[model samples]
Target: MNEQSPLIPTLPQGTPPEDLVPIGAPGGLDAAINPLGAELWFLRDRDGGHLLWNGNPDIWSGRAPILFPIVGRLRDDSYRHDGHVYRLPRHGFARHARFTPGAHDDHHALFRLEDNAETRAAYPFAFALTISYAITGNTLTIGAEVANRGDTPMPFSFGFHPALRWPLPQGGLRAAHHILFDRPEAPDIARLDSNGLLARSEPSPLEGQELRLRDALFEQDALIFPEVNSHAFTYTSPGGPAIRLQTENLPDLGIWTKPDADFICIEPWQGHADADDFSGDIFQKPGVIVLPPGEVWKASMSLTHERSA
Candidate 1:
């Protein structure tokens, strides 16, 4: 394959924003990135509340900022807090809000979001969320920072969802891909129900293989992996460079692909979907984080593409 710049349409200042971009051609890297060619990056705005892509916070990408997915969806966009229920949009309001652009050079850019009246009404907290994207050689580094600005404590979760091109030789319903991890023990897989809620699946070995993606596999929605050992997961084609994702503090990983769809979502999360019998307390939610008054919490992960030996 030729080493060509990813295709993305240029959005001059003041143009209507678009989340998807073409990649993999000349002068393409500067265009907004989409999954049609290779990989696309997504990020959230200053408020960290909007979805930015599909009006859902968990999935986002666009032309100017270089789309990358972030956050997860809360059921009905509602969660219980101290016995009071607060309603938020699908992935909260972070992705839709305009972000303050961070200083950048030629290869990288940074964006930030915060919580205010609009955010407080839905989630009731003041906070800051900063996301940075940097590219060096063939690797991309992504980082996120969250700070609590409320007088009282706050509870929340965070994560990343990236879709990479399946560089296999053939494309069909029976196409297979191999996934390998850096850890010894396989992470616990959480099976999603018909309603998209997650439940624990039977523990299985992390043996490597090229498994076909069939329609039957997605009947359960997504494969959620908890108890991961801050390691990396790699996917490779028969004769292509490996696509690798690494995490440090994140403890959860989700692997999902739409049935008959052209792409797969490799999601790294700090939190997860609501449980089947959830009581609604935000802190009690699985993988939820509790921040003390004026306290701050941070979590991040990175992705890289490289040739296999």
Candidate 2:
């Protein structure tokens, strides 16, 4: 694992800030990504009513956001490192950090965010984070690679949050849709407390491979799976065909939606939030990925637009 991508991506001149790199397929799948957060904001499955959830103000402001450094809340929103205290907001800083366009072709776009003076003040680590999005036919694959550019190993957590249309613009009972898991899931999913910290586990509402989609299920908060047996699932709705996410190198899972929201987020994570009764050093926390100097930690998830069920 001695491969390193270029330091930055070259953006063609006259590219607008709102404009995204386009990835299209002859079968009618189209998508675009913005440099800000290296986020996938727009995804169209041929017919084009927008397959990804449109950011509704009352609901959520994110379409597909990448979570990094730390996957969830730290106790009191702060942590200690090397005998010094640091404050980092929930989900770390990757979502808010502006990534520089690395190298991109017609079907793939790579964006990189490296440690700088501003990041060092908060994170205190010299590392590089690169996110790449690729499209092949109706499939969109997102890849995140963390490189420890420093002499010491870098400890970090990573996650992916992708919200799809609940009922879809194609139209049905938001509850009519259901998530089809590749294998039978455990009867219980992990739970998070009011402060966004994880606590004791709870029995899951699911009995089989499919969990019927419903708004009421998230009345309290998110449904988290600390260790899911399968890493892939497909979302099916009568309003539209199935939208699938197949993952590699991602073991944790979360299903969440705001109160009465018309979207559901299927999140894949390499780590989770801090424990409710635990407060420890940042690098010692559970699920913290340690990358040796010059070594790379990478994960990829593929989103596919499937034919109607």
Candidate 3:
């Protein structure tokens, strides 16, 4: 790679030339593409660092790069599609796949992932997934599209996991930060057992207090909330501004932070953690989406930061 070389792979002929510009640093595994935030706005790690969705490769973030957060199978890497079982790396392949930039101007670009042989062995269905990211000023709009490519029916689970930097005021700690979901009622927290399985569910109350990130809190895994009223959520600091994330076509939400870590992950999911008593049928899982042949499924989410009045 040279100073003028592109950071990502070269686009195919007839593809939009403007969309193939260098969005990140040269020769680095990951680059800081967007300048709106201090952190690298997207995640495109090393060659194999990306996730594979049904053989459709996608990238993952090692340093705060925007990437797809394919739930259902983030860690330990495996899932049971139909009555048969298959396995792959964590978070699926879509997160690691090198997407061809589409629908580009100066403010926004679209990245896409499609099905392939490697993905068919595990997922066993043809599908087209497109992610369109539009950046207008400080706001980013993320759009997801899933289309069935096979004649037979296909069932799967998917979600988004964008980790945002928690900006605390001077001399403040993460324990002093608060997160508010846009809903009138409380949420049900999905408990994870020692074996990283969904053990049970409980109520979540956001009473305007600080959130303590500890290992014991994740002992039961992530906090999964289903049947939420509002489509947006906010993370605010007592003495500073806040960031708001909104999503539709997402029936579930996950709030997670590394044990005693500095950042918090506000995840919008269409599916959830593995059940302790799964029947090996993908559709039997909660919040699973089943798409017919030639059918297209779409969902979108956005993130914006603003000062609190």
Which candidate number would show the highest lDDT if scored against the true structure?
2
Q: Which lDDT value does model 2 have at 55?
A: 63
Can you tell me which runs of candidate 2 are displaced by over 4 Å? 1-17, 238-240
Compared with the true structure, the alpha-carbon lDDT of candidate 3 equals 0.56
TM-scores of the models, in the order given: 0.74, 0.91, 0.74
Candidate 1 residue runs with Cα over 4 Å from true position: 1-6, 9-76, 168-176, 186-188, 203-215
List the candidate numbers ranked by lDDT, top first.
Answer: 2, 3, 1
**Weakest 10 consecutive residues, lDDT, candidate 1?**
44-53
- Compared with the true structure, what per-residue lDDT tens digits does model 3 show for residues 30-64? 32233221122333323312111111112223333
lDDT of 1 by residue, 22-105 (tens): 122122122222222112333221122111122122332322121112234566657877777888654456545666665655
RMSD of each: 7.7, 6.5, 8.8
Please list the C-alpha lDDT of all candidates, in the order they appear.
Answer: 0.55, 0.82, 0.56
